[model samples]
Target: MAQARCPLPSLLLVLVAVVLLVPRAAGYPWQVCGNTGSFTANSTYQANLALLAIALPKNISSSPDLFATTIVGAIPELVSALALCRGDANATTCSACLVTAFQDVQNVCSLDRSAAIYYDPCILYYSNDDSFLSSADNVASASTNRINLRNVTSDPARFNRLVGALVNATAEYAAYNSTRRYASGEADFDQEYPKVYSWAQCTPDLTPAQCRVCLAGIIAEMPRLFTDRVGGRVLGIRCSYRYEVFSFLNSPVMVQLAAESGNSGSPTPAMGPTSVTPSAAGGGEY
Candidate 1:
């Protein structure tokens, strides 16, 4: 018989030391696996593993309320957590990004028990202990697209206009948005092509006001952290902000965030990135 295909984004194996994950045509975002480990055979360990795997994202579609249910049921635990980065990202891209992060947790954390994953547009968290629910207090994670800005200081006026709009619009969107939990926009500059392409988002679970607080914290750090030639950003479990001179998001987001929205307040003199404690975990490290 043809192999029974694994339909969802899952790794399944039974009665043996093995793993089988169906190839996802989609791509996942840039994620970090905070920590994770392999399981030895035993009733207790198996039960714990199952509990953490209680409800993956695909299952949520069938029972949307499952996310907030009790974390324990008999011996099985249900502490799964998943967040989409930006709706503009495609299913394939998101899938690929997630898989990359999953691999990290599996590889480095082969011995550790707790695990976390970070994707450019999403985050997946699971553990045998803490249920991260209602914990908007986790610290932030940061990274850059690795590309520099085209010409921020070199071409001051145009660069200022582009950055100003993105910083402002994204802050507003995160403060008040929908299931997408995202905001993105662009602005024109006098020197080069469309001056900027930008995007921002927070996990939907956060209240509108809470989202604002989280994103604002990140924005406050941009000036000094901001690289004049390349795109840079600070990513966190609750929120993320990013932009590039070139289009980097899905079509819808690309259209919206790359439209050259005009300038905002006078550009504050760029400052330095202050020291902020990095979250104990960004992506899991073995």
Candidate 2:
């Protein structure tokens, strides 16, 4: 008996499946505050913003802090701009991320006097007001993982506790231990399932205590903000935290650190097809 083959329809279906499976690059999310304030073309504020956009990336790349803040012109027309790259990012990555952010901000928030762009590798914020320089604004913008935590454990509550401990410890290490104010590591809950890899970072200008506070605030919000998610992040002007079941850091050092800490288990082999993409779910202005 010969089996009849439906090759054409089957091929089309396979192609459709492949397209759906591929992950698209979402880049980052940004906010432009037109009602809060705005600037017109050819205005002094606009000119200052243009200059700040060009200078911020360069300053960040050259500085040891991997953070840069500048005020162009006087207070009224002054444009207070800052660029903070993720602590683990290399200078090249920081520069490119800032460059993309600069262009993206202009496109997304064109003519707005106040705006901020949040990328996975960096953040760019500029405004007519300088208050953000010293203030810690936790609610400005944020996102979380698109996928939920695979229910690998019998006790989801216990999983949450272990994740919290790893994230909190990473925050402390970022705040007090690293010169770059960043830390990444992993923790093993079940030897057979994926180990949770996490990282936290703060802008170096913040005092250790301040950095801890910023990290803590976001960490506390995770359960409410992205419950049941295997990986997610909460970003703020002063600090941010991220964790995942995969190698989000994309660095071997994270694994080494976990091993040194005696949690040598690696992320569980992909049990199924899961997409670890970030989602721009909820974000609002300060």
Candidate 3:
């Protein structure tokens, strides 16, 4: 049999919106073990990876940008690693999350020569190949809430249009308006579901045009993956987006839009049962 090759690490781009109240939990992480190659138990590559585990977290926590990339060891045995924490995360949280990620990748991916791991608060990726450090390819993964929007079943098209506008606007702000490449906003929808909240973010290292391209790739997937869902997210190594009916992000929403008028939309239905929190974390290997 021919040997199979693992695909390149997929970028996860998340766009989420929630309906019912879901309990929030940290949840399990999504990980990809690359097909590039492997390292021996005590090889020089292993030593370099170990050094990165300690150094990356410290560097990211200390930097105002909350992002860091490093190259360790000479070529052949070299390792390149990058880490990014969500914009709203505190320094303490960013540091702690990366420290845990470094330990977790080893357990989950073992001695793989390259790997990528995703969590709610952060992302960590390392490899013998450095091409990914600057590349913003469209490889992607997405997650959606289990519940549908309360009114979406009545008028899915309208709901989708609103979501597209909100997400696209947020993406523009994250790319052009925010130095950190992060943005959150809300738009008025209907009387029953009065507001929709959304967020967008990209790794700070990407240029504005690169950031826009990264986010647009994921947004194009929204109609297929998240049309009527109350909450969904697409996560990419380079960029990500999320939306919810209820507010899930921090204070000071970055952008706001008024509800569109003139549409005699369908009658608002009774609210769904509350108290169910959407799953906070989910992903799949590409």
- Tens digits of per-residue lDDT for model 1 on 1-286? 7898764444333422242242211123443434334455554655654543443433433333222222433323333345453555555555554445545554544434445555554555555545456665444322222335455544554465457456556556545544455655555554555456677677667777777677777666666566364476666666777767676765333213233344444444222221111112221110
> Model 1, 212: alpha-carbon shift in Å?
0.8
| Candidate 1: residue 142 lDDT (0-100) | 21
- Candidate 1 RMSD to the correct structure: 13.6
| TM-scores for the candidates | 0.62, 0.73, 0.76
lDDT of each: 0.50, 0.67, 0.73
Clash count, candidate 3: 30
Sort by lDDT, best first.
Answer: 3, 2, 1
lDDT of 3: 0.73
Per-residue lDDT of model 2, residues 164-208, tens digit only: 667776777677766777777676666544578887888787787
Report the candidate with higher TM-score, 2 versus 3: 3
User: Which one wins on TM-score?
Assistant: 3
Q: Which 10 consecutive positions of candidate 3 have the poorest summed lDDT?
A: 277-286
* Clash count in backbone of candidate 1: 43
- TM-score of candidate 3 relative to the true fold: 0.76
